[model samples]
Target: MVFFNLWSVLQWYLRPFIKWFLRKTTRLCELQRICYGDKPGAERSRNVEKSLMLSRTRDVKQVVSYLDNTVLERSFVPRNFPEILNPSVAIILRAKKINPKLHELFIVSFRRCLAQIWSYRLLLEEVEEMRKTHYDSSLPEHEEKLLKLWSLLVPNEDLESRVTKQWQYIGFQGDDPKTDFRGMGLLGLENLLFFASEYPQASSHVLSHSHHPKYGYTYAVVGINLTSMAYYLLKDGSAKTYMFNARQYLPNMNLFHKFYCYLFYEFDKMWIESKPENMMEFSIIFKKFENAIRNELADPASVFRINIEVDTI
Candidate 1:
């Protein structure tokens, strides 16, 4: 037992040295490739070297932009890079080795990259999980909760009605509302339920906007679309800036749901304020809104929040 304990202690102490050695060896090999320019993959290695050098000199936005335009667009890092580097500790070690003078910039850039990778992995796993989880109507609890959510959203409507075009008022695809949830599965329902249940006033307010004869859009469809937009932002690494600026750390589902709520409220305002001629313009309008959001996220200090004071509907 004592011998085993001693071995464990030795291993623990040696871990950092081992990691440093590995990184040093990798750096040396990359430098050698860049110097020799003979190997087929040398050019890629040279790019990585250039990236490292640029990371040292560039500001946070520049580094993030470079990464977004280049590294993230391609498959430069493996999916498990975050686990290997562990972002926080990796930043310290990286700063020490790369350029201590630019430690602040290094940490910021490293953290943003780390956040992007981690957030993307989380989003992919979440989306796949949601896709697998079909909404089972047979479960009484699920049915009851879903109906309860409906009641909350449309208090005046009769709950016992089997089918009605009234469902269209809230943006479901058909008389049977379950079909509308087919693409997003239970996740979509849960997000809507959360919005309605947690912020009943806000949810009902948005529903009213959906009823507008001129500029209104489908409530549920728009909600699902916003979910897709949120997922896209998360998956593509754009949300990293927002998440990083908001928390300076990786975000969990709670934060994600809050972001969804913000989108729900904000998109309603955008739709009303822009006053599109018809529903056919939703794609163009949504793209414009997305670009506006991307520009806001480009700022390092930007933080998204749910403003309770914003007038409902």
Candidate 2:
């Protein structure tokens, strides 16, 4: 009777944890299947494959095997934030030419507004903490600081109130990979930042050339390992480093222009650099690259796309 009673107690205590473990395992299996592509026998083999991969108990050798050399190189190279800001600066310059007032708007979006958004995010976190602690002491001080910051950043009281209210829902809680901004594609945070920092007259600047009225261009290049190389190069400074990393891609450069149009166009204004002296050389190189990829690159459907989760508030 005692043994049966102990077994019952153990089951009761472990039921919730067992249920959670099963749910987590199911989700992981689903993700793995998605990554491997839905082949006929893929699902059945995954569990066996997973067990084989994890069964290795070696210490140092296991770590060495998992180390990605390319990632290590990229980590060492420091990227200059200023280079990324160049596009935003160009947008401001173009806007200033059309409407001087809008140049300030771009600055506000890039600088002040972005800063205020972070500040509000921090305030929201503190407010949540205060709620958990059930203390009014932290509330007064936090409210005072938030009010001061809000007034300086947002002059309009109504707008400040509205922004604060909405911020509560959209608050970033933790380093949740699922909440990363990659999943939304065109409507993602990167686009939002570009949208905010870009001037109202961006369309006009992009459409300035009579022959092409498109607002943006995309560049898709192909090479044996251009994707792998470019991914790292983007993290580092000096355009020269990128050129070196992607040297092999140069031969097939033509593939880039053929597949992705953005390479030849300025992202903010979408100006085409097709003139012989300008970016024609780039186009030729990229077209050949595209052709090579089309011939050699296997089924692209099996390619793993980067996954970023969106946090909808």
lDDT of 2 by residue, 226-280 (tens): 2222222222211111222222231122211111222212222222443333333
Query: What's the true lDDT of residue 128 in model 2?
Result: 30
- By how many angstroms RMSD does model 2 differ from the true structure? 25.4
Stretches of candidate 2 exceeding 4 Å from the true structure: 1-61, 66-207, 210-313
Per-residue lDDT tens digits for candidate 1, residues 37-84, read: 322221322233344443432343343454444333433244644554
lDDT of 1: 0.64
Worst 10 residues of 1 by lDDT: 37-46
- As for candidate 1, its clashing pairs are none
